[model samples]
Target: MTTAATDLRADAEATLQRLAGSGAQLREDQWRAVEALVAHGRRALVVQRTGWGKSAVYFVATALLRARGKGPTVIVSPLLALMRNQIEAAERAGIRAVTVNSANTDDWQAVYGEVRAGEVDVLLVSPERLNNPEFRDQVLPELSRTAGLLVVDEAHCISDWGHDFRPDYRRLRTLISELPEGVPVLATTATANDRVTTDVADQLGVSGQGDGALVVRGELDRESLHLNVLSLARGADRFAWLAQHLDELPGSGIVYTLTVSAADELAAFLRERGHAVTAYTGKTDPADRERAEDDLLANRVKALVATSALGMGFDKPDLGFVVHLGAPQSPVAYYQQIGRAGRGVERAEVLLLPGPEDKDIWAYFASLAFPGEPQVRVALSVLGDAGRPLSTAALEPRVELSRGRLEMMLKVLDTDGAVKRVKGGWEATGEPWEYDGKRYLGLAKARRAEQQAMLDYITTDGCRMEFLRRQLDDPGAAPCGRCDNCTGKHYDPSVGEDVRVQAQEVLDRPGVPLAPRKQWPSGMDALEVPLKGKIKPEEAAEEGRAIGRLTDVGWGPRLRPLMRSDDLAPDAIVDAAVEVLKGWGWTERPTGIVWLPSRTRPALVESFAQRIAAIGRLPLLGALADDAPPRYSDPEDDSEPEPPNSAQRLAEVYGRLSVPVDLDPSSGPVLLVDDVSDSGWTLTVAAMLLRRAGAPAVLPLTVATTN
Candidate 1:
């Protein structure tokens, strides 16, 4: 090697020693990646295994470049948890790292000041922040101008074909295009197939050839990961099995669930079984999430019951086991999640407790995927005609999609250059756009296939590790001598009868309190609805209850198909409803019952309501979804095509429920019932009608609630 090459290697080695230890040595491939970035100023993609020192490459490069007076390294990361870990790790290596994210808004000004003053070596940003108006307009331009190195961590998200779908990642192409020339770029991910790798590299403006990134992909298999799958068809059986076997597992690790409700419910059940555990999901508060992560790292908890929110970039090297309560939809996702375990240990047990509800849960999530052409057209039309930038909430009253879905669609539109996210809100670019129906259809097909692949992982006669490796296009896919399939050492999935009984009780018992809508959705006046601000307490519904959330462990999914049946709710459901009523903390008892009009399954809802009133010996009132003509109507059009937005939907439903005009407030509170609570708007409107018709308090009860 030449003199400068030797010096670069020595500098990188010194940085690695600081990062790892006095004797820490750089791996050959790690050095090559570092050399490409620091010496040649070339783009690099590192696709190493979870513990193969992917992070070391970037940190070492950052140190070497900064020594030569390069600007601070900018890393576009996926999760706040990941950013927190990176910031901590960078500090340990003597790199002054800072983060800008939603959780640290109060610190942003200070952080930006630090960046401007050259006191920071590495800066981590969440992917969504790439287009955040404040960050994108003011802070991001400076980052682009002065960033010495650019890194996209968890780069699989940049691919259209990757297991994870994050639209904000696509904005990296624009960021890359705007970067100053010859700024070395690095992309890293523990999870990515050949397809994803190519897509990400191409998006980074690299073609994987001469003058392109050095794609350094190492072996995908981890010799320390001992894979096993325990198939328990019943939900109760799965939890019982976990309760019985959690202690026998190697060390403190993670027990991943498919839904937030499942994560919370399972964590509680595990605690009841005398295990120290906590639930982690997207719903968890930012500070609490950080605490839970720290607790796990310190071994204060046996395992964190988590959803995919805990999936990417959490650094726990000695995690002994990874247990999945329900299968993830893709084998790639399953492998990357399990990579959290066995990193710094000799052997880490990775177990899959596949439930029958896994497929249904996958289907429910799939329903939230990209919208169809008509909905996309509606949003575009609204934007094109508005002629002004509209914030997401302001646009909601004119669009049919929920807030979450609407935001996701807007991001996708922003990526395609059809719209731009500006300081005020989002502005239409007036770029001609067409929905990629074929592309979306292909994505849908790929999702179904991935779900099948996960199912196949359970029943596959081949090596479990090999099956997962092959799913990611690993050319070195081979039998792992330690897997249950290879060694014939299957786990005993048996649950004690006592454990089963206790778990079944937890499943059978259920009630979820439903909070009433206090404030009206914004931009109602723009939709020509005179309503705005908080609904008067006298005109609002009191807090209510649901038998459970639609994502609950056992009862939630079962209700959907059962709701279509003409027969009344089964005795078990009716019994649960009674329990909910008895447990409800109502200041005054409800004097009567009122059912929401169901556009679908009216007979089922009405029958359920009649049974509840008879059992409670209370009076029954009227139906609500669309039973009464809207209180407000345009004289030119007696009817409006089902109002397309929130304000429109509220206007159409407002004062429409025909409550008895003579009903007396002294008759006491009214029990408002719906078969399902989706968006909770209809329930809000119906409750307002009852309160206006002289009911002192309106309480809403639904069999299940959907997000």
Candidate 2:
């Protein structure tokens, strides 16, 4: 055993050295952690939040293990997207790695052949694939015969406690049982608490005896991060706050909302305010997700407003902030979601806007934890068995509860420090007990205490990290010192603070417009849309008439008109106030959709019109591919037959519609004449054609993407 372990250690080291040479810069602490894994003859469990380079730990470990003559290293991941990404990354690094996913059959066969022949170094497989019988029967037997290392990425999912729990993940332990006895196992995750740590070790059957399993915890501190949380009341005010900030902190950022509809609406709202935006949700097509991600990375989008589904393995280093439109269930989820920002060594911002609805959503989730104590006790007893820990596959059918209920039970147990999560199983932290012989009542009391702890954190008034620690019973632990509450600051929420302040100073009055700055000769215009008053128009009219009869006070043109309009709705009256602007060249498409073509400043009109047109044209062009021809003659007009695809559509549209003279290659920058970008085919193809036609550059402008 000693000799074999030493050999594995040596092999893993060489791989790390090679990786370091290949452009991954590991800090002293990070490199030390990798070396510790090899030197101790132990499997490493690296838990670091997003953007901390979690992938590097496994990549280096797998490389080192294989270089030491390990037959093949199998990586089990949750998503096929993640698997594909790793495969492509390895190939780009000149490492021969292949993956078996839902996409290919021939590729699977080739990988199986390579494993059987002991010719492959890294084999990336999804957890779902491991359950397939054909691959198990035809290929796994060969893997058992050779020296192999099993790497579970996103290992936290093995715990019911994690935000993302897949039923297929539980079966991973059973599949790993097929590996040679004493074969090493390594698991990696972004967010895992202490309970999650122990669960991973037990699941892999490498426990207290130290069958070479070690924990490596990365530092969670991100000094460049600036966190801000707003306790909000009104929807319009919330949007108003967002608009004010985007201008100051301009660049790539993600605005995370609770639902797809919210993401779409928020994206639209931001785009209308002149920000280039994109919206994403789980319902978005995978290909479209890839395109949106690419556009974001290329700086084609200034912002992306999305739901939680957009996260995991998506990296863009220069993100300016990660704004939370709604509160998440737990700090773990919040941390993972917001860790996407400030990754490029710049000070990044985090804005959390919480509303009353968040409280209800959290309460609903907490309500599912009933009988939490007994459920945790059951989970503990199951893990404490001397036999191999039950994998996700084995536990699901045997639990006799819905998968969601089981997951909730697991999370409660894990959060309460009653159970620890292993790579493929869990570890019991001893069964739940009462303070005295009254076991049932004691358990009930304990469970309530735990529930209260969770609730207290949610509604806390003090330091956020302090509350988190108190819930964990680790109150002495120093504050995270990174959260909004810990920072002791608040961004000005007033939408017109600067203008109002300037006006106040200039006019020596509270309500007045300030004079313009030296460069901006036009005064700053920021209007506050008022809320409807409680009094009805009829009541107001009666009050007005009484006052007039007594004091002989007559109303003027503007003031008297309001007294006579008893039938008008408050919203209708406000709408009428803006009618003159609309008739004088302003445009109103629908409620919440308005633009000013005339009477509006020239620069603003030109910018907004271009953005609107650009967005409208995207649907027509998105049908084309990268290699498709630039232009095709219209066959309907006795010209060459029109190209049948996206490329052809672009040519036809450009041929027939008005091409902005500014976008003509012979002219200046390719003009972007639209506000939203749903499918980028039109703009992308047009830009490509212009480049092919010798244009120096094409500027594609859009208010937002369907994202």
Candidate 3:
């Protein structure tokens, strides 16, 4: 080899050793990726399996390019956990890396200063940061003009066809168009299928151009993983199985759940059974999440019960196992999650405990996709008429979408050029946009197909590894001798009856407190609703109790079906409601009970209230009389009214219920009963009317809450 080429090889080896260990060496394809970027300054896409050392390729390239007097490398990462892990890995190679994300706002100024001063070797940023007002307008332009190398980690998100598409990742196209010529760019992901790979490559300017990106794809196989699937009939059975078999797993690992409520519930149950585990979800506090990650990495805990928030870029090399409590909707997502295990250790167990409710969860998430033309037009019209930028919080009261769905829709609009996110919030751009109904319908169909594929995967009798490889369209798909199906079933499918009984007890336990909404939604006055500011103390309902949340993994299955059907109140639910009442420590005993009028499921609410009244021996007051017409529209109607904010909801229900005009004030507090509490506005307004009728107070009691 030439002197310079030989020297580059030696440097790459030394860097890999620093990153991994003394004996670490790059595979042939990894070296080829590094050479393409550092020597030829060409864009490259590396599609390999997890644990293939994608980060090492970028870190090594960054060092080589910086040594050649190039400017700092900029990486657009997707998650904070990934960024933290990358920064530490970079430091191990003697490369300085800093991150700018929501978790570390105070450090942005200093990080930017370091970048501008040419003292930083690598700068890591979240995809969302690319659209920040100050960062986009001021810092991004300079970074684009001067970056030595650009890296898009978890790059599958750039394509809508990918399993985990993010609109923020789509914003990278703008940044890509601005980069100067001759700057090497690299995109890497382990989860993309053939379609996603091609889409991402074209977006990286790798197709229909001179010297398209060199695509480096290797065999997508992990010899260390022993895959298996166990079908459990119910959620409680899965919990019981985990409690029984978790200790038998090899070492510290992660337990994946499809929903946040499931993660919290499973973690609590595991802890009660004397296991050291913590819940990690989007709802977890930032500091607490970091601590949990650290604990798992250090082997201080048996496992982290987590949702998809723990999916990408978490670096625990020797993690012993990965257990899925429920199946993800797509095989691509499932493969990515299971990839977390057996990265460093051999024979790490990977199991899927499939449940019947998996498809329902998948459908619920699919409903939050990009809004249709009608909804988009409504949002743009609201912004155009306002003639001012509206923050998401302010826009929420004016729109019908939930806060999460609304933010997602706005981001998609912002990317499509129909709206511009400004300093304050968002403004209409007046740009014509077309809602691709065909494309959306196709995407919906694709999602259903994927769900079915996941189901097919569960029932497949062939090699599990080969099944996943074929789903990714990996050309190297072949049977692996490691899977449970390829061999025989290696995992036990049975749990003891005692464990099942214990799990049932935990799931049946009731009482989730319902916190009252204290402050009102913003800008309600413009909507012709008079309510604003903090709720009056006397008008507010006291903190109340519900049998459970509708989303709780324990009670959700039971409560959700009840909400949809007009079935009679289940005896178990009635008993649970009594237990809640017995345990509820009210300062004053309720002298009477009042039932909230239900437009739907009146029988269920009345039956439940009667059961409580008979058990507590309180006088059963008559149901509240509805004087006004039905304020809420039928949920099954396509033209149903948008969900109203607190003010609008209160306005609709105000003066609708009539308490007895001459009800005795000598009666103590009254218990207001409802089938469900969504916004808590009905209870708030109902409490105000009861208090005005001279009752001392009103305490809300419900079968389920939607929060």
Candidate 4:
């Protein structure tokens, strides 16, 4: 197979020019991404957020590569719906696309053959399809001869921390590696944090610059959406609120429910109210599911009542709203579901219903997530006594449950803090027990806290967005200023009389009431550092320390660093000192750090400062009233952010990348950084370009840069 760069790629360039002349205006990033692909001969990670026209990153690159006479790109997606979605989009763009899924056996073979023979430019298949040993061994090897790329979409699935965790995704690393070295790998996902990015690079075996290659993200916020949170007293009240708003909310929308019964009943209720309603659930057949999806997309139905499973790959730009009938199990799930609306830059609403039932449901789910102490203890004992990996089947007789139930319990335990799942079997994490007298007390305590958080969300009048942001471990978020409590007349209390004010006044007095607040740092140990501490204002003032401890640990750092040599007020001194500590890696910026003796990483200094800054904005509520339903002076802004260096860009770039470069060419078509290369355009492009151009040697390096 000839590489695009080696062949001088006139055909590809001609095809690209033709497409451009035919009305395809490539954006700068897209152009740069594609150029990097052809020039470097290696994969690149492209992480553009939604509405960044990420598809063009792949569509144009694939078209350009194929136009240049390179082999077709084989995209391994996770969902069949995603395959169909992309294929249809490609067809609309005048690009030929097909899929190899379970539904089409003979055609799948034919397509596989065509791809191997260099007859096709793009083929999409679900990741599960590649799990077939026969396809991986037989068909993939044949296709390998023609040169192809492996594109893993929704790359976050590879990380266990992702909300949508899939065990099958773990095998993606092996599958990509099986491709010849020259074939670049691209992995993309909408949401990826630092940990997720690291995991993705590790799984793909990306090395050096290529391993670190990823596009920073864009904001995921849609200002057109009028976000709202309606805290109802009961499930019935939630239904009533939905009914009240149903007439006002126009355009097609989705109503996501927590249960199959809820979806069905909601659909029925809406139908009774004289609206065309479609219901979708896991039980729906493929035909029905597809029809329901099409109906929702086509605006044939006024509303579709379904579960979170319904919206993964469905792109309905005009969806005016997304209603969560019940609180989601986690903030991640909530955000993704609500993100479905306002895709078209139009005003939309995300109505969250957190009724009493939701609290019960959340509590039940938390309990399920954290098994009983006896169960955890039993599982641990079994694992400890075995001293060997025991399969669920083997452990069932001793555990007193069906193998399936025991396995699920074990998974929950894994999800919770109780155990770890391994290829061999489950094992105790060996974390210390929580309570000395009781064996399962720790597990119980964790479950109770989780449940309590759920209850807090349902009952608290505080800012919902703030709670969510805190849960996601991101505190830079300000009040959304648009949620129910944030905008309500009830929130208009005098700044001095706000919850924080009252709490601060009470805390200002020294007494037993302040003692528990002193332990706030220890009680909220997971959120240590940048909370509160025990240092006195006078001492802090004299020492030029920016932080004064409220509790032994939880006080926000005083803003001493803001002080100038000529003017050093106590607050200014504290803020200024905070900056110094942050610079010295003793505090986290955007928040402050507590003087905890353990787990103090230097990188978290700035984060600690930032955390300190966060709480200062809160009206000082007394320690006892701190946990109560504190009234918000204003809602904190915690809307969806621009994809902050997400994974989507990287995956898309990798998909279309065929170039690999080394030594950071001072002058060249582009610099391509790939994790590794055994065969495709990356190495081919570099070698051919250097030889043809008569330039210096090209160096290909991986973090563990492959030769």
lDDT (Cα, tens digit) per residue for candidate 4, span 195-252:
5666676776652364434443444444556666666543444454465457567688
Maximum-lDDT candidate: 3
TM-score for each predicted model, relative to the true structure: 0.95, 0.56, 0.96, 0.55
Alpha carbon lDDT at 353, candidate 4: 67
| Clashes per model (N, Cα, C within 3 A) | 2, 29, 0, 107
Tell me how far the alpha carbon of residue 409 in candidate 1 is from the true structure, in angstroms, after superposition: 1.4
> Compared with the true structure, what per-residue lDDT tens digits does model 1 show for residues 306-363?
9999988999999999999989999999999999999899999999988777887887
Score candidate 2 by lDDT. Answer: 0.53
Give one digit per residue, the lDDT tens place, for model 2 in 1-707: 47865565555445545644544466554565556544444666776656676666666665665665666777887765566667765654346777887766667877787777877778887766654556655565676567456778888777655556554566666666777655666777776667665676667554445455566666565666776677656544566667667767646888888656566656766776677888888778777777777777788987778888777666677888888877776666676777788888568888778654554445434434334344445545666663555544344433333345665555445544465555555556675633223543653454455444544554565766555443333425456566666766777777755533432222121111111111210111111112122322211100000001100001011222332222222333223223312332212121111121211123432434433334334212111123422344321122332122222233333333323333334333333322222223344434444445444444443322222
lDDT of 4 at 191: 54
Consecutive 10-residue window with the lowest summed lDDT within model 1: 634-643
For residues 1-707, could you state the per-residue lDDT of candidate 3 as single tens digits? 67988889889889888887899999999999998899889999999999999999999999999989999999999999999999999999999999999988999999999999999999999889998989999999999999999999999998878999988887888888899988989999999998899889887775425675788988899999999999888777899999999999999999999888789889999999999999999999989999999999999999999999998999898999999998999999999999999998877999999887777678668867877677678889999998889998778767767677788889888888899889999999999988888978988898888999999999999999999999999999999998899998668778999888989888889998888768766777666666778877876778889998877767988887887766678899989998998899989888998888877788888988898888889888867777888655423222553555454566567646677655543388898899888878788877777777777888899999877
Q: So what's the TM-score on candidate 4? A: 0.55
Candidate 4 displacement at residue 406 in angstroms? 8.4
Off by over 4 Å in 3: 1-3, 208-211, 625-666
lDDT of each: 0.85, 0.53, 0.87, 0.50
